[model samples]
Target: MSVPLTLAHLVWRMKHVHPGSEVVADGTRLRFADLADAIVRMAAGLHRRYGIRQGDRVAVLAFNTLEHLQLMYAVPLLGATLTSLNLRLDSAAMVARADRSRTDLLVVGQEALDHRSVGPAVRAAAAELAGHGITVAAAAELAADVETELPDLREDVTAFRFHTSGTTGPAKSYEVTHRDVVLHALSQSAADASGLRAGDRVLPLVPFCHVNGWGLPFVAALTGASLVLPGHDLTPARIAGMLNAERVTVAAAVPAVWFDVCRHLAELGTAPPAALREVLTGGSAVPRSVVDLVRDVLGAGVATAWGMTETLAVSTYERADPSVRAGRFVSLLEARIDGNSGSPGEQGTLQVRGPFVVGDRDGWFDTGDVASLDEEGRLAVHDRAKDLIKSGGEWIVSAQLEQHLCTHPSVSAAAVVARADPKWTERPVAVLVPRQGRLVDETELRAHVAERFPAFWVPDAFTCVERLPLTPVGKVDKRALRARHADGPVLSPDTPGGTR
Candidate 1:
């Protein structure tokens, strides 16, 4: 007889087999057995107090905390779908996503309700959600003294409703079944994949709101990897300290967060935790500098991943060797480069299909990335197809240019965007943030790009800025950059207000 693949099995395995595994958050550490009890109690409370039942939706607006993690499992155990709201989004955007979820209850975390920057927005969103007849309550209210038995849940029932990062367009929502969560977790824990195991102390610096913390929470429960969740205070100094305090073995976050942590370590003349063995980074291309810093400073190997909210946030993983290649596909997932499905070294749009991967009506998901496949089927993403600049019929990959520019000694971060040009149709322009106490010279930047890339690929103009804007999920906000350079007198490096 075959068993259904659901979260129930994962919970059972964690409680029975890995009861000693702990989840650390904000100075609180709860072992697997204790966490299982919490989930049971929380499920009972939701059922008895809020009347949350099977097929209902419960949305959470909180950071990565013990309470948030409990709700992640408890709502699904109650046979209700769990929805997460992006904390970085504004009040209106948050309200829109909450409305779209048709949430029966909204649980606002105390930390979020108390945050200065995000508190107002959370309150605004809660007020609007409550006005819509959706029951809104504080996250602190999720507790009960009695433990209740979990109901039988089907494998195909929707467990999570996730929103896309909205990097290229408006954020979109997708559903993942219990089977999708379980199978993805099992695939990620494979030796050749994320390699999460029983002894590994995994740190997910990524927000729970982002692809369910890149699905690491479930992988931890399935593989017995202890989780070290970085709560709301994501300061660089705080994160570096946690890495040492927790003795983290496998840490995951976007490239920007890693960069901050590396900088913090460098400034303090400190070393990364000796147990930090691997750093899993994605969201955008992991720069070669970041990979080098992780190895030289953090004493950790870098695993560059390629995934999206649609693909469960880590479908491909590579050892990164300081290269931007997105590694080969993991088990259960398959990809093709446009029309060149099996051909090696062919470049085109990347499309994927798999049992756990979400797809359109045609059964294949177009990733909207211009990519190439190596002889071993390893994937290398060039750039977003829409972000590529076409000048004189030649394509200029903005991601490649930005990565190359970031390698310059004077540059800390860089972004390349397409500027409308009547003569060439579209021209590449560079926005740069200089290293501390350094200035970026446009001529030097041009020479740097022309040294490796073709002469025409060199950005036509360079604008020096203090920093590049980022999307809610922390990828470079190229849409904002393009809008800035869309109609302005192309601001020169010498412009007084260029930094803005």
Candidate 2:
């Protein structure tokens, strides 16, 4: 007889091998053994109370709290699929995701329901969900003391329903099986990957709604790494305190969070926690400055990861010099540049194939990124295919230009968007956020870009702004930039045209 691979085995590991492992969230701490019991009880309660069965979809709208974490394991253990709705999304988008996933039950965290900005959206989603014959309940009311037997499930059973961050366009939904989750978690646990292990206190600053907190929760369960959920208070101060107070050895978040945390630590004159060993960041390109700050201020190695919702969080991790390359492919994954004929120097759309990856054609998933792969299998993503600016039939990579422009002393952030021009069909336009208490000039910025790039690659127009708009996931909102600056530059106080 063959033994099946399922999350049930992970729960078993929690009960037997790592019973004493801790899970801290919102000032409450629980051992793995206790969490396992709660998971089983919650699974039973969900089944008995809501009649949730195999193939049913349970949607959760909440922050990174203990209750939210419990539902991640509980809903799936009952052979039901867990659909995590992005609480940061607007009410319409949240409802659309729930409706698209065919949610049979909706669990709203009490904190979410009480939130000022998210409350209205949750109530709106809940009201609409109830109208569609879906059972809606508060997360606080779902826990049960009832003891019940868990069901055995196949590895191929759908365990999670995830949606893309929709940074470029509308959000798209996808499903991951038990096999995918287990394999991805195991792969991430490897020494070269996230290097998760027992005794490590892991804090996932990434939201659970975002690819299951970038799969850290499950990795913690599998490896016996104590999980420290950040809960709703994502302020950099709070995260910084938790790192030292909880003795976190491993942490993960997007580049934006790390940048703020670095500043916060500098403000407080605090050092990186002694126990902290590594920081995993991605979601968008990890700037070299952020990587250097992590190493210099946090005194930890930075794993600049690259992956998407379709690729199961992060597929590759570059640790040594993260800013230059995306990283070598992790175990159980493969990558190739589309249309590249065996030349590592060739650039094309990045396509990946892996056991856990979702692909549209054949088994290879087109990553929508224009990238080049070195002989060592390292990936250098140039820019998103849609974001590339074509001028006089020559493509100008926006990400490269943006990175170079940000290196300027007075610029804190930069985004390069394509502007329509009758002469060249399209020209590069730059939008920059000046560093605090600093002002930049269009002439100096133009000269800065012209130094490295060709004259044509230099942006035709430059605009200074107080801040760049961001997507729900914290990536620079280039789409919005294009729309806002399509015709001409929008002058701000810092803009050369306005009084500085």
Best by TM-score: 1
Alpha carbon deviation, residue 352, candidate 1 (Å) = 0.6
CA RMSD, predictions in order: 1.9, 1.9
For all candidates, the clash counts are 0, 0
Model 1 residue 107 lDDT score: 94
Q: What TM-score does structure 1 among the candidates reach?
A: 0.96
Which residue window of length 10 is worst by lDDT in model 2?
491-500
lDDT of 2: 0.86
The TM-score of candidate 2 is: 0.96
Q: Which residue pairs does candidate 1 place in steric collision?
A: none
Q: Rate the local accuracy (lDDT) of all candidates.
A: 0.86, 0.86
Q: What is the TM-score of each candidate against the true structure?
A: 0.96, 0.96
Clashing pairs in 2: none
